[model samples]
Target chain A: MPREVRERQMLDAAVATFARHGYRAASMDGIAELAGVSKPLVYLYLNSKEDLFTACIRREAAALVRAVRHGVDPATPPDRQLWEGLGAFFTHTAEHPDGWAVLHNQARTSGEPFAREVATMRADLVAFVTELIAAAAREAHDDPELGDREVAGLAHALVGAAESLAGWADTDGSVTAKEAASTLMNFAWAGLGNLMEGERWTPR
Target chain B: MPREVRERQMLDAAVATFARHGYRAASMDGIAELAGVSKPLVYLYLNSKEDLFTACIRREAAALVRAVRHGVDPATPPDRQLWEGLGAFFTHTAEHPDGWAVLHNQARTSGEPFAREVATMRADLVAFVTELIAAAAREAHDDPELGDREVAGLAHALVGAAESLAGWADTDGSVTAKEAASTLMNFAWAGLGNLMEGERWTPR
Candidate 1:
């Protein structure tokens, strides 16, 4: 394989290993072995274990954010947009279970730098949720009752519910993405609207 | 300290240390020193790190279950019962942050036997939510309308929301138990009622 292709293969192997064994437990030799290369060659491509892990975090985080962002269309009804965003999330998590595990489980446990990388991704995702709520509010102008606290709390609940549901859906091998999205919509949108009795949204 | 007092102290220290450092990262030596006991003494009472971790899981899991069970008054309205159950969950997670970390984060990540122990605790909580939904349906008097899959999905969403909120509230460091309870009540009760609309609690 070409160097770039070889490097990508090594990273893929590293992510899968990191996802299963966690950062502390995953060894560089094991990763190199999994990639069908020597440990020195793996180092030549990725430099070190820390660098390799960081690369994995950045790749996975960016992919997840990109997928969710791409899944949404700002022009659509906010409810529909939220559903698409959630669909994107569930799909990414399912398709890249190892990558998702690395980002969610291993990255956090890796401590310090790795934790910060995932934290940034979380904040980004949280902001996306905040915007979705604002859009929903704008689309359904009923009252001035929805305050920052309520919006923030609702966003937290929605995002958290999505994360939790992703893990749950993964465990029950039979569940589909459409089913997961619908469940979250029922659990979130109706309650949010009732709470928002009166809130207006405008362009940023 | 006497052996009984020393044992309790060791267990408390173990729970705190394990909560902070996780099962794999936490050292028995560190726990012993923190408890003001000798290493052999910790070994005397706890036997090994695995047993020590398991003991912590069992104790904290039982405490959490007891808190929720004790918090709800059986005579109250089903809404109130669910409200109280949620309140208990928030309170337990808040007051026992270390134990919460162990049960929610550590044990769940450790895999297999440890995971199963915590899984049992989670199953209890899920069953409680399932039963609560059934009772809500029974009280409402209309046909439940929801299939087993739908109810199970809702239960998972609710449980995940509760767990997520617990972690979020802790991270923010300012949300009190009452505020957390109200946040959840606002987010959940209305959404829950929407499902049971034909039965009892109208969406309005």
Candidate 2:
């Protein structure tokens, strides 16, 4: 097999192992056997367990980012774009449960460089959502009610909501990706739509 | 001082240390000095580092849950209740940044018992939000449009959004707790209000 194919197998095994057994408990021998590769080859190719885990984080994060980016088309209306983006996110997370677990569950808590890697991805996602919301606001009205800070806050909230929903769907098993996407879309877009129209919810 | 007072001091110090230096890096010596107690006294009171961290998690988690519960009035309208609940949540998180960090960041990734401790708090929060949303749905319509599963999903999304917004406010520093609460209230209430009125965002 090509080195690339072998490396992919190793990463797949590593993500599943890390997600199922956690970072501290996941063993190299198990990962090697799961990959169907020799222990020495696993070490030689991935360097170490830490490096292999880092590789898994980078690949999964990139894949998720790319999935959302590709799912959204700039030419589409903002709400549609968000719908597509969220659909893509939920679908990817649902399909790649192990990868999602690695990124959201394992890497984040495993410490140091791993957490930082996920943070960078999170920052990128927040920035992407921020731009999306800002554009939607500008398009909706001449004078947008959402200030930059508020827009930033909204983006964080939306991303967090999606993440939480994804985790929920993962655990519930019965919820499909489409259902997760719709749930968040209704929760977020209607809220954003109301905000755009200046129908703010104030304390009574 | 009495044991209860001394224990509170130790937990306060532990939470701050764990938040700042992280669980593993946080030292018994540092926590003891910060708590104004001897190292042996710290051990005697808290038992061990693991126990001290667990104590911090339990204390902070309970305090957070209590604050949110106390913030809402059952007699008030559902929307008002949500607003007050969110307001209370943001205020608590903002005021207790160290405790928030300990629960949100430190306890979650520290592994095993610590992670489970935070999960229990999270489940309780989710259940509380679920009940609130379900009550609102029932109040809004005789035949609620939101199914049980959908309501459950919305609860997860809302909790996730609050968590995200709290973290954002903590980092931005300029964003006050009131601002965070208001931002989410608008984002969530407006969306949820529309959903109650059957104004969902369908794909175009």
Candidate 3:
């Protein structure tokens, strides 16, 4: 096999193992066996267990970000865009449960460099959501009353909600991607829509 | 001082040190000195570094839950309840940044027992939110249309959003706890209100 193909296979096997057994207990022997390659060859190609895990985080994070970005259409109305974007995100996460587990659960808790890798991906997602919200607000009104800091806060909240819902979907087998997406849409859109129309929820 | 007071002081020091330096890098000597106690006495009371850290997680988690519970009034209408609950949450997190860090950042990534500790607190918070949503939905309609699973999903999303905003508030010093609570209220309540009114955003 070509080196890249072989490396991809290694990463695929590694992500599954890491997702199942977690970082510390996931053995390189299992990963190599799953990849149908010798242990020494696995080490030779990936360098070390840490490097292999890092590779998995990078690949999975890129794939997730790409999936969400591709799922959204820039020209659509903001609500439609958000719906599609969320659909893509939940679908991607549901389909790639192992990868999602690695990125959200394993990589984050494993420590410094790994957590940092996932943080970058999260930051990208937050920024994407921020732009979507800002554009939506601008489209809703001539003046765009939502300030940068408020937009930033909303983005963080939306991303966090999505992240939380994704984890819930993964654990609760009955929740399909569509259902998860709809739940978040029901939980977010009207609030965001109200904000766009300058309808703030004030204390009574 | 009494042993309970001494232990509390040690936990306070440990939480601060852990928050500042993280788990592995946080030193027992620093914690002990900060608590103004001998290192051996600290060990005698907390037993080990792991136990000390665990103690910090438990204490902080309990305190956080208590603050939120105390801040909310059950007799109030649901939106008011959510608003007050969120206010309590953000205020607690901001004022107890070190404790929040221990629960949100440190314990979660540190490993099994620690992560489990934080998870319990999170579960409690999610359940609290779930009840609040369910009650709100019931109050909004003669017969609540929102099902059990949907409420569960929304609770997860709301909790996740609050968690994300708390982290954002910690990082962005200018964001007051009231501002964080208001931002979430604006981001969540209207959407929730729409759902109660049977207005969901369907994909066009």
Candidate with best lDDT: 2
Clashing residue pairs in candidate 1, if any?
A143-A198, A143-A199, A144-A198
The lDDT values for all models are: 0.82, 0.95, 0.94
List model 2 lDDT by residue over B1-204, tens digit each.
889999889889999999999999999999999999999999998899999999999999999999999999999999999999999999999999999999999999899899999999999999999999999999999999999999999999999999999989988889999999999999999999999999988878
**Alpha-carbon error at A147 in model 1, in Å?**
2.2
What stretches of model 2 exceed 4 Å from their correct place? Answer: none
| Candidate 2 C-alpha lDDT tens digits along A82-143 | 99999999999998999999999999999999999999999999999999999999999888
Tens digit per residue, CA lDDT, model 3, B19-116:
99889999999999999999999999999999999999999999999999999999988999999999999999999999999999999988889999
Docking class of 3: high
Candidate 1's C-alpha runs over 4 A off are A20-30, A33-36, A109-113, A138-143, A198-204, B1-4, B21-30, B109-113, B198-204
Q: Return whichever of 1 and 3 wins on lDDT.
A: 3
What order do you get sorting by lDDT, best first? 2, 3, 1
lDDT, candidate 3, A91-158, per-residue tens = 99999999999999999998889999999999999999999999998898888889989999999999
Question: Residues B35-132, candidate 1, lDDT per residue (tens digit)?
Answer: 99899988888899999999999999999999999998878777788789888999889999999999987887676578899879988888888888
TM-score against native, each model: 0.88, 0.98, 0.98
Clashing pairs in 2: none
Shift of residue B111 alpha carbon in model 1, Å: 5.5
| Residues forming the 10-long window of minimal summed lDDT in candidate 2 chain B | B195-204
